[model samples]
Target: MLGVEAQKSPKGKWTMPPFDPRFPNQNQIHNCYQNFLDYHRCVKAMSRCGQSSQLCEYYFRVYRLLCPLSWVQRWNQQIQDGPFAGKI
Candidate 1:
C-alpha cells in the first residue's frame, strides 16, 4: 500500500524523507532532495533524451516530478512560500 497517510513527511522529525536505509546520516533531508533531483534527471532522460514515451510515460513523468515537488512543498514550506514562490 502507498505509505503517505501513515507516514509523515519528516517535517517535524530530526531527519527527513528519502532517508537512506543503508548508511546513516543525521541530515537525511538534504539527501532526500539530492535523490529527488537524481530521479528527476533519470525520468527526463528516459522520457525525453535517449528514448521517447507514449501517453503512459508522459503521465508517469508528470506523476514522478510531482513527488519531489510535494516533498518540497511539505517539508520546506518556507522555500515554496519564499523566493521561488508561485513560479513552479
Candidate 2:
C-alpha cells in the first residue's frame, strides 16, 4: 500500500487551487484576487484579535499559487507604498 499511501499523502504534489463554486467559470482571475485579499484580511483580523497570523497561511498559499508572479509583485509593492486599492 505504499503507492496508495503516497498518493494520499500531499508531500510532493503540486496542484492548482480546487474549483471554487463561487468562481465556477474557466477564468480564475477573480478567484486569485479574492484569495489575495482574503490573505491580507485574515492577517489583519488575526492581529486585531490578538491571534497568531500563522492561521492565515491557507489564503497566502492559495493566492501565491493562483496569481501571476508579476501581479503578486505589483500588489506587494502597492501595499508597501500604501496605495493598494483592494479592500484588504
Candidate 3:
C-alpha cells in the first residue's frame, strides 16, 4: 500500500513490479536523502577502481523523483567540492 504504485517507463508504459514496501514509516524527504547518500557511495566505490557506474543509475533516478530541485542543487555543490567530487 506504500511506495509508488505506477511510474512512467522510458517507453511511456506503466508497469507494476512485485509490491515491496520499503521505508513504510519514513517520509519521502528522508527517503530522498538516504537514497542520495547511497547513490553517491555507490558511485564512489564503483569509480574508485575504474568500474562503470551504469549500475548506480537506479538510485539517481529514485532520488530525482523524491527530492526537490533545491536539495539537488545543494547536494550537487557539496559533491563537487567534497571528497566525492568527480566520482558521481
Candidate 4:
C-alpha cells in the first residue's frame, strides 16, 4: 500500500516522494542527486560492514522516484566507466 506520501492524480496516476526535511527547497534536483549518491554510499558502507543492502532501500526509492530515467542511466554509465564525480 502507498503511504501518506503517495498522492493520486485525477487520472489515477500515483505520485511519489514525500517531503524530505533535509531538502526543503522547491527544486528537487539536488535532493535527487543526493539520494542517488546516498544509495550508493549506503550500499558500499553496508557491504563493507557485512550488513544487508536492504537497509539502503529508502535511499534507492527516493532517488528512483525523483531522478529522471535518462539522468540515472547516464550516471550509471559514468559509474561503470569510472567517470562519476560523486564521492560514492
State TM-scores per candidate.
0.34, 0.79, 0.65, 0.79
Clashes of 2: 0
For candidate 2, the lDDT comes to 0.76
lDDT of 2 at 72: 79
Task: Name the candidate, 1 or 4, with the larger lDDT value.
Answer: 4
lDDT of 4 by residue, 3-65 (tens): 233311123233677889988988999999999899889888989999987777777778877
Clash number for model 3?
A: 0
Per residue, candidate 3 scores C-alpha lDDT tens digits across 26-57 of: 46666787777877788778889899866776
Question: Poorest 10 consecutive residues of model 2 by lDDT?
Answer: 1-10
Per-residue C-alpha lDDT of model 1 across residues 1-88, encoded as one tens digit per residue: 1234422432233322343554276644545454544544454566666664232332233334334556644534544356533221
lDDT of 1 at 24: 75
Worst 10 residues of 3 by lDDT: 1-10
Candidate 2, residues 1-88, lDDT tens digits: the string is: 0133321323343487766799999888999999989988888898899998778777766776778878977887888889899987
lDDT per model vs. reference: 0.42, 0.76, 0.62, 0.78
In model 4, the worst 10-residue window by lDDT is 1-10
Model 4: residues with Cα > 4 Å off, grouped in runs: 1-14
Ten contiguous residues minimizing lDDT sum, candidate 1: 6-15
Sorting all predicted structures by lDDT, with the top scorer first, yields 4, 2, 3, 1
Which scores better on lDDT, 1 or 2? 2
Q: Candidate 2 at 80: error in angstroms?
A: 1.1
lDDT of 4 at 47: 90
